[model samples]
Target: MARTTDGNPERLAYNDRVDRLRRKEYRMLKGTTYLDHAGTTLPATSLVTQFSHSLQTLLLANPHSASASAPNTSHRIVEETRLKVLKLFNASPEHFDIVFVANATAGIKLVLEAFSGHDEGFDYYYHRNAHTSLVGVREHAASSHCFASDAEVEQWLQDEHSFSGDANTDRPTLFAYPAQSNMNGRRLPLSWPAALRSTSQRLRTYSLLDVAALVSTSPLDLSDHAAAPDFTVMSFYKMFGFPNLGALIVRKSAAHVFDQRRYFGGGTTEMITCIGTQWVAKKEKRLTDRLEDGTGATHSILALHCAIDVHDMLYGGFSEISKHTGWLAKTLYERLASLKHANGRPVCQIYKDPAATYGDALTQGATVTFNISSSDGAWISSWKVGQLASSKNIHIRTGSLCNPAGMACALGLSSSDVQRAYASGFRCGQEADIREGIPFGMVRASFGAMSTLEDVSIFAKFVQDHFVGKGLLNVDDNDEKRVKSEEMRRSEQSSTPSFEKPGLRLRPVRQQFWAKFGACIPFRSRRPDVVSAH
Candidate 1:
């Protein structure tokens, strides 16, 4: 049984039950402790089995057949998966059009391409800490603006407020922002979409939400709001499953703007044409099939279907999963706050406001960001911690994590300042040259459906052991035997005869190989004449 910091046995046993269930539920990778669910998650065993079955039985069927009596089993599977995805987001079939693409980047590109012609007076806006794909979209749009906060975005959209009355509103504006940011795991308020809609209505602009991260934590319901966004994009892989599929759900009103023939060929058409001959477009079916250009990944789509089913079965539901993650996050934050180093210095500075309510805490999602402050005024990088943890079979990630702008804002540093500090040997949480700006980034720990109370406890204990310079946890008799065997090997090697001896030189062979492939090659030097040199 795993005990909490207070040493309460009752609480420990309860938590242990949860952990045991999680262990039995998830097919955890052998010899590795996973904590980077934000990057990707390990799929459940059911998903794998279902994926294999579907791939073997149905994936090879031709998408387009001339036979009128052809079976639509594959199409049925696709539709079922689409319905599951719609259910996950609480969206209706008509209002939300699900177009399956390769991945998140492809989805973003398709949406941007759909709105390519309306880039006249359009100015793209995103938070300073948005995903790189959004930044890339802004660059492609060529007329983009960035804001630090919600207030700044609202202020920018106002005509009578800032920059005088010359506020340009010629083209349809698109704001590509995350529902819950991947970096630092910060969940934007529910009011954010409504707020954007309210402001954009006055400015005659549109909004496109990137809800890739938020899908795992909560069900997105866009029905009630007076002002709704034009489109939203999400990825299935980030939550739990396959990597090659993504989804884009567009508002019904904005459906007509997507050109059917923009990027053509394959299953998107009814018939091909010869030179000067007219072609037929499949207009009778739904718009989703019209936008779907090629034969979809049947196996991956089925895998996603199984993934959702597994999520529902094991985690109970999205609400229960959220509760579990929230509990873990809150416990981790509180425990990290109370932990101290050997010299009585706090290991991490927890960020949650003490006065915030439970609802307010839920708004942040299940992610904890902290700074490890050391006693000698030095600080530890999350990447370094990740490396240390990996040596003990635990896995995590560090650095700005593709949100350089957000990292800059949160740490109060300029882009150049961050670059310079990183160029120096400065770790996270260390005070640096203020003139260059604030000098550290945040380290984030995120939770998923399979993560349990024991995982959190193990992490807390690991942190404590590292601070006090102790051995790793779960080091059993096998590890001791391995260490003993390694020591014996070293002793045997020491007693063995030296390689260097009279007339028994093995150095010449090594030298020959070394000369053939020198450590450093000179780019400017001419190639040796192999025949003449030999």
Candidate 2:
């Protein structure tokens, strides 16, 4: 039996399971502490071993081969992998079909291509907090809206506001949003798809969910097909960290939306006449065959199978993995939240949902994003922090995170201000951050099922050893707090919620989680005179 860190049934089999997983399968993490699981988890040796064994013993070839001697297992493997992916998500094969793609971005493009085939191009609506992949879809829409808040989206769904031309006309519509924010691990409402379907019957709406980040730790429950999104996309590499493959899960009920896709590729067609007048007859039997443009990634798909076996063998199930990673996220959040300077200033600024708690699987994932600060409240360069952390062999992710809207929202950046900065010499990967004082990016420390308590402690200590106590301040005290311009101040006011903003929900960090850990990671001699901005 795996031991629990908190001596609770909910956290059972997590600590001991991952501790063993690290020593046996993940020997690469022995010397270094990797906290960038949000970017990609470390691929385990067992996964590679199983995959290598299959490659050495078996003959696999392209499924599209016309030769009779070409192994028949490739087709079987492709079909089995689809079933495996569907089984992992708890989606019924009767109602759902998986289409393999290069990555999540490619899946998104396929859906957009399908939507563009309509008589009138589809209207696109996406959450402002979405990843750049979702944000880029606006270019293909007949009309689009970047909804700033849930309230605005709900109102739009109510038919009170409309972005498409002639609201009365039945123009096809698609709403894209991430299951969890890639910038931070804030889990958005999973109920949005069912809610979109309940709106006025005069229009048609489809939901495109990007679950690339969500499935990293938790299982996506598609048990209720009626409530699931029309189309969902995710990368397998984000989950098991190998092969670099992704899939698009299409609800058969909503598969009609894809009939508009005009282009068909090699294996997708039944008959093609290029000599005479060009006429194409596509394979209409399966949605997967219709959209998958070229030969499938057979070896990568087999690797996914091996990954699933190793994942199941080690963590037991996604539920257990979820519980393990969630606890680590909450614990790490608490530790980073506890860090402070000698003069009572916080060492980090964590960005999270005020209404959501960390330990809850529904509200938050196993990722935490924030920027570091000086003792005098000056913004520390997030990229600089990443470099220093890398020096200590504590790997982490930093920068805009390919989330421009979330970056703008969190960093109090206005459209004009960011534009002006870019108009100047400011650019991505530049040493100088935005403006004269604003941070160039934010920092992220994410957890995986293989992550142990030692990794978290090492990371927290890395932040403490470098940023806490004395001699860390480089900027003048007067220049610490930068004066926000009028536009920037207004953006910040709208971006941040009021304390009394009705939904002020919080979860208490379990006492056992802290008391048990306090003995291992020691605090500095000088206690913080003031509280952190929790």
Let me know the TM-score candidate 1 reaches against the reference structure. 0.76
The sequence of per-residue lDDT tens digits that candidate 2 reaches over residues 139-247 is 7778777776677677777773554443324468789999998888989999999988876652477899999999998999998998899999999888998879999
TM-score of each: 0.76, 0.86
Alpha-carbon runs more than 4 Å astray in model 2? 1-13, 69-71, 160-170, 471-532
Instruction: Show where candidate 1 strays beyond 4 Å.
Output: 5-18, 29-31, 68-71, 119-121, 156-167, 199-204, 225-227, 270-285, 342-344, 350-362, 419-441, 468-534
Candidate 2 lDDT (Cα, whole model)?
A: 0.76
RMSD in Å for model 1: 13.1
Top lDDT: which candidate number?
2
Score each candidate by Cα lDDT: 0.59, 0.76
Cα shift from native, residue 229, model 2 (Å): 0.3
**Which 10 consecutive residues of model 2 have the lowest summed lDDT?**
511-520
- Angstrom error at residue 297, model 2: 0.9
The RMSD (Cα, Å) of candidate 2 is: 11.9
Per-residue alpha-carbon lDDT of candidate 1 for residues 1-534, written as tens digits (9 for 90 to 100)? 255544545545545655666566564644456677777766777667766776776634554653543236667788899999887777777677788887777778887776665646345667664777676776555466666665665675553234223335565566778777777566665555566556535444556777777766656776653455677787888777554578888777667667523666567767667689766655436777777777777767778888888777666666656666667777777777677555565666543322223224345667776655454434454544554565566656555556656655554455555555556744332222222222254467777766766667777777766653222222346544553454355446665433443422111111100001001111111111110100
